[model samples]
Target: MTGGDEPAPARVQAKVGAAVLAGIGPRGAEGTDGARPHSDGGAGARSRSEETVDVRFPFEGTVGLWELLDDMAAAPRLVVGDERVRAFLVDVGRRLRAPEVARRHPELASLGFFLRRSELERAAGPLPGAAGSLPGAAGSLPGAAGSLPGAAGVGGAGEFVRVPRGLVFHVAPANVDTVFVYSWALSALMGNRNVVRLSARAGGTAQAILTIMRDALDDADPVVARTQRIVSYGHPRPGARRIPVEPPHKQLEHASPGHHASSDHHQGEHSGKPPRTSPVTHPEPVAPADAGSGGAAGPTAVLSAACDLRVIWGGDRTVNEIRRHPLAPHARDLTFPDRSSFAVIRARAWLEATPATRETVADGFAIDAYWFDQAACSSPGTVFWVGSPIECAMARDGFAACLAEAVARRGWTVDTAMAVEKRVAAYGLAADGVADAVEFHGNVLAQVILTSPGAAPRRWLGTGTFAHARIGSLDELADVVRRKDQTLTHFGFDRDELAGLARALGGRGVDRIVPIGNALGFHRVWDGVDLPAELSRVITVQ
Candidate 1:
């Protein structure tokens, strides 16, 4: 039987190369699921069984430190002023978003990736002008660096840190793809030749992005050379995944499933899992001893000491966990937690009695419920008032109706909605007391639990993407702000009342208070003082 002409060996090699370049591994290999095979492979039952090898480029120990610094210095200037380079970087970012790339590497969506692109774009762009500069283009950096064409600047430049040759970075945190990027990018940016021991789960994005960048830069370009030697590998040994016990918050997301299971099994086993042999390094570890002799070392010190800078982003749990570490005494880190954010209403003072006020209030409430699907800390978790009880109650009703309608129309599914409903239903079945009323629609649920004039900061209600809101007397709302757990509190009050509320919360250790929706967009300096400080060092050129 004459078989259809078989492809020549050269054609097969070319096909194999294309598949490999596309990030497709051999069939039956881990991570190959969702991968598309090359067209040449065409329903063939007899394709060659190829073994995949991870690409590695080692950093030589003999490279001189001064040579490294020279290379490092070139990166900032090349990246900052060059439009071509910025576009190239964006191209790399787009490549990361490709399905073939994203499925093979999940870190494209990481904060690290966001930070890398942000920092790279910022470096390529103009530096920020001094504070209080004029309104127009007179400010050197775009009103906001890396902002889409007309957006305002997010914050000032991130501090740049240079790592000398021969040092290594032990990157932790698989959940956050960008954490790896921060470490890897710093090593590349600073001209430090280094190794990145990838978190087993999320190294693909980091690996792919680095590969693309390394391939794109010219050999003679200092930035390219500095970044070229960086390498990524899983923990050399399988059992090496140990994170030091610092703040419980720092370890919360990275906590091992084994550790969690044990915690459940043993109930009181405070000593869950021993630190993995891997020396769990982060941009911020423990803060320095000098910040304060007591209390946990802030986020900045810990992260700065490890690499050059650390970039942290998440909720209150992350911030609190880092704060609770014993190393909190020695590490400096930065944190961007959901402090307080709010929505504003600029209607006329007399509008509270008019229909326009109801429309405005409804718009604000709808924003609070649906914006960013409520995951953003900036989404108003609470509301404030200036009008009489009648006005406030009317606003609340309008807000509730708007929110319910939005939920129904959009079919948004919330995480805690179902659980709350079940809990409320169970309570009704078992007890004689009046249960806190909760509303549910699919996965979106809203619950209103009455409290004494001021009970604990209202437990933010909602399941997945919903929020728990409280309608309280202004005095009672102020009292809620004083509680230790109320972070990122946004208030919607008259402009005059804002400063007073800010000062009141500031005294109680609250971090930020802003017009609600604006909370998610600002990138303030020393906001949390974790990553930026941790990843950078002060160099006084004598």
Candidate 2:
């Protein structure tokens, strides 16, 4: 929703130069276009059924890799003048999103939020500042001088690491479709030519995003050429379907030891079983040279002279897989878990607040929940209260009423209600004694639990549930903050209490503690440090 009466363009480019760096290509001449060039011995060539689309790379052969990278480094400067491209991109995002259709299908909504142009641009815009700052004091490096903002020239030396011309980048993750856009943009910004392996499930969104980038680049000013020329293809294997791995503490439930033990035993039995005395069983020893060369036979080695960067955004299994590769030590892995966060209110604030203030706080909670059905990390999965039992009860009632109203306004249906019931039933069985406290409202639910100040730090104020919201006391709030499982905890209190809680929680390992409603705002700095400083490589020429 645009905040003003004035008619603003439905879509505004969030970051002007950054998208070019992300490898979005220029809009091609009007017509269907073929794939770009690749150097991996035509490995990109693959057949696709009309009904089932398969992403294909444009280039073929080893030489194509270097050529593509060179092309990308030069792409930001190429200018194409096409007005249709932006509209086409919006249409692509809309079609791929199909928000209206998605709203009717409850199951699909759980995956994540389908953001509007304003939201996407808002998120994408801040990245450029991060993207432009390289680490290692590379900011002043000769070639790096002009790459970032406020550089002497229009375009400074590229700010990111320059992957020597022939490197191949392996991208693994599916949760955030726009993630690749960021990755490719980083590569382009760094002046590296890259080939992206997209998650299979993200094919549709990837196609749309890539198509838009390509069209936008076709008309980009030559100054932006250094940031284009990236290729994307969906990896055919289903290995990319894994959930993102959060830190161990954030895992949904503790992993079963039996699972690991059984796997180990199975491996041990296979390893310890005496060589079968039978000739048939002993006849299959392969030569070491043959094993080495044979395994390499499927695809030609396409290594660049420099180290390769394998970016992974998946769960434990995927992380382990990435770790197994010889280059794993050099890879950069960022994890995003299926996390649910929440807000906490100081009981006094609720009791002392005017009717309007109470309504404002409740409204904030409702807005957070409705944003993406409370499935996003930004959504408040629970609320903790620090007040008298009576106040807690009142707050609980107010929150529930607001949640129900919000759910009704969104038009939840029988099927959605049934799905919530099934989820509750399953959670009730898991939670057993704690199930009585859980409350459901159509597709949304709240679980209120009371705990004295002295409860064990590990004790949860509420049981586990998707999009679950909980309310508890401040003392109980401290306990939850101390737990390893909690990723985000927002404290709603006046300045003094906020500072005190921040200090206490800081000591206990809380990642972030912000005001209740402002928790959803974008954070340029994380962990009290600038993210750009941590993520970038700085080079100085002087």
User: Which TM-score value belongs to model 1?
Assistant: 0.46
Local distance difference test scores for all models: 0.36, 0.37
**Candidate 1 structure quality by residue, lDDT tens digits, 1-542:** 23345433333333323332233222222112224444554222013222111223222122222222223333333221233433444555555565554444332433324434565544323235534222222112322222222223433333222223322333344433444444444333333333343433433334455555544442223333333333223223233233223222222334342332111222122122111112112223222221222221121222222232233444455445434322111333444554443333322232434555554444444444443334334445444443555665455555556556654554444444445544554344224332334344444444343333233223333332222334433334455554333234333465566667666555654445554333433332324322222333322121
- What is the per-residue lDDT of model 2 for residues 340-438, given as tens digits with 9 covering 90 to 100? 355676666666677677666665565454443333344555556666667767766765675566445544333444445446454553465433354
Q: Relative to the unseen true structure, what is the C-alpha lDDT of residue 132 in candidate 1, on a scale of 0 to 100?
A: 28
lDDT for 414 (candidate 2) = 31
Q: Which stretches of candidate 1 lie over 4 Å from their true place?
A: 1-331, 335-380, 384-386, 408-411, 414-436, 456-478, 482-496, 522-535
Top of the candidates by lDDT: 2
In candidate 2, which residue ranges exceed 4 Å CA deviation?
A: 1-173, 176-196, 203-211, 221-308, 328-332, 336-340, 351-367, 370-373, 412-414, 417-431, 446-476, 482-491, 516-521, 526-531, 540-542
Give the lDDT of residue 102 in candidate 2. Answer: 42
Question: Judged by TM-score, which candidate is best?
Answer: 2
